[model samples]
Target: MDRKILIYPRGNGEGKGNSMSMFLCLDETTLPPDTKLFVKFLLRVISQTPTKSDDFEFKVENHFGPSCLNWGAQKFMSIVKLNDPKKGYLVGDTCIAEANVTLIGEVTTAS
Candidate 1:
């Protein structure tokens, strides 16, 4: 499966200015026309601190297709919490984001 991770540091849509937005996006161009995918995915922001890692994570299952290529949380994590040093999400001005996706099934129209 061809997939990509999308993150908005300043957030997106509803999350803008309040939290970070993260999403799993299916590459529609790589898929056959009228194809749909059922997928389970996990998205995380890894803490960079050496002492402890308080990761922020979200998981969900959804369908993706040409019309719906993306699915994820609008409020993945609060901006204040992510930027706080105590949270350990950002260290030395760097933060790590991860995505794990599993393809549960696929369907395609017989055209």
Candidate 2:
């Protein structure tokens, strides 16, 4: 299955504060049947310009549990704290963020 990764800004509905996060997910239709596996991945994000960065390392197992029709998305790096000025999360009066994702491996059931 093909996986897509991306980054975006999130804010409370009340307009309290905004934060950055990453989403790693795959298409459920392509999941191998009657099998369970562990997905190891890394998500990295950096300023589109030149500035700070962030990353997450973890594994997603039981992604195809019965409760979910689709494998669904795995969200990470929420509530990221961004410092203004030096960090330059926003520069040139523009906000730019880039995301990169690497799928390390998928350990499937032996039987």
Candidate 3:
């Protein structure tokens, strides 16, 4: 299965202008009709600091299908926190993001 991580630097929808938004998206076009995938995933904004303790992260478990191809947090992290130099989320005009996905199961409907 193929997946993608979407990041809204200025946020998206409700989080716009206030926070960062992140989403995990399943490529529904690659899947057969009526197929659902159960997945567990972690999304993170890695810290550049040596300690790495200030990394911002979130975890989600969900079923992805054609009807709902994406899922995630609209208010992932406050822009203030992400922009704060002490937080180490951004360094040298670059931001590092990571995603880990594990497929738990698959469901196919009989039609």
Candidate 4:
């Protein structure tokens, strides 16, 4: 299967903080006709501050195809502090996120 990585900047609370959203896009065209794909993954995020790593990990599974998968609203973590500079999450600070995906199996349906 083909994979695509995507990232975007997201703001919260009128300068209270900033966050990054990461997504994985899988190309559906690569799958065989009438086949369904299932995928699962664990996501991790790391910030500049050693102890400030994201407090959560994500695990998800869904039908694989030309769709974008990412963390939901309750899972998104603030990676930057735009309103405060002393917090170490400065404007130019960088955060790293990763996703480990596993393909459980593929099934073909009868029409």
Write the residue-wise lDDT of candidate 2 on 23-87 in tens digits.
55565666665543345444444444443443223334434322333332233334443345455
- Candidate lDDT values, in order: 0.88, 0.44, 0.91, 0.54
In candidate 1, the residue pairs with backbone N, CA or C atoms under 3 Å apart (3 or more residues apart, or in different chains) clash, namely none
| TM-score of every model versus the real structure | 0.92, 0.48, 0.94, 0.58
Q: TM-score rank, highest first?
A: 3, 1, 4, 2
Give residue 78's error in model 3 in angstroms: 0.3
The reply for model 2, stretches above 4 Å from the true place, is 6-8, 11-18, 49-85, 90-111
lDDT of 2: 0.44
Instruction: Give per-residue CA lDDT, model 3, range 1-111, as digits (tens).
Output: 888889998899999999999999888779888899999999999999889898899998999998999999999999998899988998878889989999999999957
Report lDDT (Cα) of residue 63, candidate 2: 47
Winner on TM-score between 1 and 2 is 1
- Candidate maximizing lDDT: 3
Q: Per-residue error at 91 for model 4, in Å?
A: 8.0
Q: Please, what are the lDDT tens digits per residue for candidate 4 over residues 1-111?
A: 766655554633332245545556666667666676778766655434556643345467776632433233332455543224454344365545566778888777757
Model 3, stretches more than 4 Å misplaced? none
Pairs clashing in candidate 4? none
Best by TM-score: 3
